[model samples]
Target chain A: MRFISQTSSDGVTEQLFTLPATSGDIPGVLWTPDGATGTRPLILVGHGGGQHKQAPGVVAQAHRLVTECGFAVAAVDAPAHGGRPRSTEHDRLIGEMRGRMQAGGDVAPVLAELHALIAGQSVPEWRAVVTALQELDHVGAGPVGYRGLSLGCALGVPFVAAEPRVRAAVLGLHGAETSAEAAARITVPVEFLVQWDDELVPRATSLALFEALGSTEKTLHANPGRHGAVPEFELDSAVRFFTRHLS
Target chain B: MRFISQTSSDGVTEQLFTLPATSGDIPGVLWTPDGATGTRPLILVGHGGGQHKQAPGVVAQAHRLVTECGFAVAAVDAPAHGGRPRSTEHDRLIGEMRGRMQAGGDVAPVLAELHALIAGQSVPEWRAVVTALQELDHVGAGPVGYRGLSLGCALGVPFVAAEPRVRAAVLGLHGAETSAEAAARITVPVEFLVQWDDELVPRATSLALFEALGSTEKTLHANPGRHGAVPEFELDSAVRFFTRHLS
Candidate 1:
């Protein structure tokens, strides 16, 4: 891992970095308390589709976790998002999804295909990110958590299922179509969110995904809203959830 | 309203009281911070089936709201519950429900019938109780919240729908079979709980009840457990929910 830039504000230190990977170097960002010296619980946030490591929502959540819970936070660009290069296959799938959505056709099949494609590469990338981040002085592996929704959740299910380092997760805004088998393998405590009137994902599929989770401690929080309109109180709940498990 | 007894412990003041009604005196209990002065948010908790105003769960929730949030909390015995007298109709319904369950028959119809019978009286009783309690110096007309599940929810659905004083509610553990129309009339913020493996209420019906609620701000919290096994964390969530809307 190589640090590219560093800045501090509101008692949180933000650092931009890159980790060498088999495909190429992966761009990422980390947040920690200003002048931190000891290891702390680390939270890895995965941004939604078309969003990057430093999306507004991701940054806000990272800051809150750092300032309120005193945890280190990190986010990495997914395979074809952020500053990463997209393959011809990525372009083809994106074009097909956009065309179908514009025609008012069901996008579930395309979404599942897109997620499967991304997860194959992103899962191992996430594992490597956890290993690299944990080795840092201020982010030593005390415990790790994951926060993701939408496209993030689509990729997160398999990652959390395969990665034992993740002790807990807050995931949702996706469906069971692509992730049910992976979700069934996850046993850590999970908080799954669902938008009751979600336009992109079918409500039944979201509920089905929650039902498919193997975690004995999973909780579903469904709010009345569209795909992007999760209520603010849920963020507070997620903070308490991670604090309970990781702290 | 007449105070029958008063006690103080752990910084929470508990008072037992009864309100005069046409049928009889409606028994109730109230909790507030010791030496509390001025009007504050009040939460009325309706105990589950077979439980009373001072049931362990009811008392624990009341004390937490009082001590932690400095809110006044109250609960009253439902019709045919606690110290209230059960009519021949109540006896018949109870007998039928128990017999159906023992014989491995579906109990939803019987339970619904029982709830309908009880709610007819309890809804008006709850309104009178709220009117009487809010007249107290410490309780005075303030934003009121309601918490109830199972039979309490069956009764609460209609009560909260009709009582404009109730600004918010946490209700679940029953189904829409008997309360869908009433639920559609409730417009306040609500937190609905669902026990994923509930033995008494079918999961689909619980989801249907949540779906039937007309509140734009309603949220559903589903945990992996049976009807009687709501996790302790939900109580904490409820406290925050009331505090957010009330205070």
Candidate 2:
């Protein structure tokens, strides 16, 4: 793990870094309270599809977690997303998905395939990142949480299922088609969100994904809106959820 | 409205009262911060079927809203429940419902019928009670919220829809069979709850009721439990919901 740049604002510090990996150097960012050190609960935030680690929503969430909960937050670029180089296979899958969506054809199968391909690489990268992040003097090994949606949720279902270090998760905006089996393996507490009228993900599939989660303590929060219109109050609710489980 | 008794505990004052109605005196209870003497948001809590105005859950929620949010809270006993006389027709429906449950038969139709019969009287009773309560000094006219579940939800749907004074509501635990039409008429913000494994209400019907709500700002919070096992966290969420809309 290597730190590339650091900045501070609004009492939250943001650090950009790169972690050496088998695939290549994985770009990532971490957020913490400004001028502070020592261990605290850390949250791993996964960005939506076509978004990078520092997307506006991701940064806003990171800042809130750091400032409100005093929690360390981190995000990493997916294999073919952000500053990562896309392989020929990645380009082919992306092209197919875009073509199908533009032509009003079914994109579920292809989307699932794309998520599966990315998850294979991203999952290991995440594991390695957690190992390194926790080793930092300022973010020692502590209970970890995950916040992800859409593409992030597609990848997160499997990651949370396999990763025992993750204590809880807030996930949604995706369907069960590609994540049900993995979802069934997750036992930690989960806070799942569903957009009642999500245009990209069918409502039944989103409900099905919530149903598939094996967590004994999972709660589903469904709001009336399109895929991107999750009300702002939900962000407040998520802060409370992580504080309850991780802090 | 006439006060029957008053008690203060833990910085909250509980007052038992009754409002003169054409049908009979409507028995109710009100809670507010001790020494409160000005207009504030008032939340009318409707008790569950077979439960009274001061049922344990109802009292706990009322206390939270009063002590934490400084809001005035009130609850009235439903007809055929909690100090209210049961008509022969009410007795017949109750008997049929209990018998069906013992025989492992479906009780949806009978329950709906019972709800419809009670709602006809309770809706107007609620309106009258609200008018009379808002006339009090501490509980002067202000934004009003409603919280109810099970039979309370069955009655609340119609009451909230018809009572324009109600600005928001937190309701669930019943299904759509009797409430869908009224739910469609409710345009205020709503926080709807659903017990995922509810033994009394079908899951699909609860989802349908949520879907039928006309409120563009409605949110559904579903947790894994039986009909009566709503998690405690939800009460906290309800407090936040009401605070956001009412205050």
Candidate 3:
């Protein structure tokens, strides 16, 4: 993993980290609070596409999980981004699968990556995230949780759905609409944050996705700020939401 | 440096690159439109503090820049952030200059970091970026511009302050008052993008800086997003702003 340690003028320090990608790499970093030293709730964070684990979606969560929520974090790189240096391997797989699909009507590459991710997810590569969460507890000084923004939301939903370990989940700028069918399967208590005036991703897209979630214990946060405002929320609600559900 | 990777189901690939800090480390990646290479103005990008170079800021920017202006870009890690990890390392020679108040009384750590970064800003870093832009130019590409959000804006303003290289500059969610001072020093035109509500740093603070710059060629973009929303412009004004200045 690559790391960037940032110290603000206020003397506060933050270390930005990037994870390496293999054939199916998830880019992200784990953030530990200062002086933290025990197993805490782990936040398996996912970032949007075109963004790596070190983007705001992941970085801001690093602070929220460590400081505000008192949890350890593991920010993972989403597909075709930060972790894999462009998911070239995935792209190649995609091409191969696409060719096969064209010939056999099967999404071979897509299924391969997602299934491998899911199969190994509970294990390293995928499952290693869970192990890392436990590690965060050992190193983070406490518990763990889950957080995702935009595309990261997509990854978190599925990961948490398959693994019942994640206590709470926060989805920002994305919703069940990313894959309504897939979203319906997720039973985790999730917090959906939306920016109504977002020009990039229409607000309705997120709203539709939120409505599609099968999870009954869900809360929606409406902020006037665009997708950029995810970090502004005290995130207390998310913490509380996760705390209520996770442990 | 640690590396992280992830890929999308469809076929998007990215690598989480952590550039180590030791003075000679420069890792910059360019997102050139499918096929193109020179003469296109290069867009030099800087991410926010604790954020990696190829983060959502740039991820979002790449999509927006390509869509709005048909431009190519080179995004890089700033000091102590992303691949190059380190807070500002104080050299006794420069650290002693802390006693010297060129900007204000005593020394502001932010300023110190900024100074260190600028002094050490390598030709290799800038040159690699320029090379990427040229590669884009080899094909048919549009004029190049610069844009930075948060700390990116902070570093960017000073970056373009004295350069005649860039055709225009777009800095968002930066301090308006300090920027006013910076704009006064810059020879090129600047379009400052500000959010309607930015809590991390007061919105008014940046507004005051904008009011201070008073550049005849200067323009301001007020949006409905937060500090992180700079990359997601809600209006067509950003495109218009860049066009007016680039041409």
Candidate 4:
């Protein structure tokens, strides 16, 4: 991993970085409080699909973690998304899915394939980044936590399951057998946020994912609305959750 | 709805029945003790994917419900499986899924689509069967329960959710957004069974589905094995669950 540039704003130091991986060059941003002094807990913030590492929500989350919680935050662009060259196959498959759905065709196979394609590459890249971060003396050996929503949950589940560095996570917006299996391996404290009537994700799927967490101390915070409408209070709770567990 | 035939064997009286629906003639069987008289609790058993109403497991469960639990049992073939005429679309999709997987392709979208296709037809058909059964004075309207494993759980989740007659259910071996959503609508008592290392169904998915159940009184029976290796002890417990909740 190599730092590309650094910018300072509102007592937050933001640095752009890139990690060379088999998948490609993974670009990301790391946020730290100005004069953060010694090592502090590192919170990895993940973004939703169609969004990048510095998506407004992700940036806000990083800002909050550094300013309010006094924790460093990091986020990387998922492969085939944000700052990465798009795959022709990925675009073709997505087009095929839309066409098939419109034609009243079965599309589960394609969705599964897409998940596998992205996750197969994304999880490993995240792990490499985590390893690289751990080697930095200033980043500390303190606890690490992850917070991702939707697509982030999809990627974070497996990533956290495989990375021992992640001691706690705030995840939700996606659930499946694969994610559930990954969740079963997560014995860390977890805070799951669910949108009760999420248009894309059924409530049961989210609930089931929450139930699958191996953590003895996991909490489910559900609110009413569509996929993107997770209440701000829930976000606050997640921040507190990370603070309580990681700090 | 019409009864096709009635046969008595092993102290259990089996009546093959059919219900006409938009999908086609829905074939089913109802089992009761040979000497059963008056109205007893009724258990609606659901068979799994690729299996018919009289699959060995389904039959055994019916037999147990009638002979041991002293309750009536009923089940029907899901659309495109068993006695039902297989759809060209379903066949084509299955072939496509197989081909895709063999080619190292993702198949989640296809799986989801296939599930939606069957559940779309199966849930409504089950609801219709429930209505038809309720009209039969001989069937009696005592508390009703459901028993389905694997594919059965997939069908039963939505079936039980929509059919208010189902006061209790034995559901597991499948977890998805559709099942989860349907599970959230269920308020009846439930006893869920899980195969820990189910090759087809992940343990996390099963656990999540169990957690999603809206029933206030729910029991989870987990065993060590694959999808088809549900232990006999769990079956015995399900019979007791029906006896307690329905009888």
Q: What lDDT does model 4 reach?
A: 0.80
Q: What are the clashing pairs of model 2?
A: none
Model 4 regions lying over 4 Å from their true place: A100-108, B1-247
Tens digit per residue, CA lDDT, model 2, A102-202: 99999999999999999999999999999999999889999999999999999899999999999999999999998999999999999999999999999
Once superposed on the true structure, which residue ranges of model 3 sit more than 4 Å away at CA? A1-247, B1-22, B87-128, B131-143, B176-181, B229-231
Candidate 1 per-residue C-alpha lDDT over B1-247 given as tens digits, one digit per residue, 9 for 90 to 100: 9999999999999999999998689999999999998899999999999899989999999989999999999999988888889999999999999999999998888888898888889888989988998889999999999999998899999999999999999999989898999999999999999999998899999999999999999999999989999999999999999999999
CAPRI grade of model 2: high
**lDDT by residue for model 1 (A1-247), tens:** 9999999999999999999998688899999999998899999999999999999999999999999999999999998999999999999999999999999998888878888999999999999999999999999978999999999999999999999999999999999998999999999999999999998889999999999999999999999989999999899999999999999
**In terms of lDDT, which candidate is strongest?**
2
Error of 3 at B135 (Å): 6.9
Q: Least accurate stretch of 10 residues (summed lDDT) in model 2 chain B?
A: B45-54
Model 2 complex DockQ against the native:
0.95
Give each model a TM-score. 0.99, 0.99, 0.39, 0.50
Q: Write the per-residue lDDT of candidate 3 for residues B101-193, one digit (tens) a residue.
A: 554454434553554455356323554445434543342334557777677777666556645566677776766534456656665556666
Looking at model 3 chain A, which ten-residue stretch has the lowest summed lDDT?
A6-15
| TM-scores, chain A, per candidate | 0.99, 0.99, 0.68, 0.94
Interface RMSD, every prediction, one decimal place: 0.5, 0.5, 13.4, 9.4
Fnat of each prediction? 1.00, 1.00, 0.00, 0.00
10 residues in a row with least lDDT, candidate 1 chain A: A106-115
Candidate 4 per-residue lDDT, tens place, B1-247, comes to: 8888999999998989998898899999988888676777888888877789898988988888888877888889888888778788999878888998898787667766787888889888887877777666556767788888777887788888888877888888786555788889998877777665687666667768877888766655555557887766567567656776676
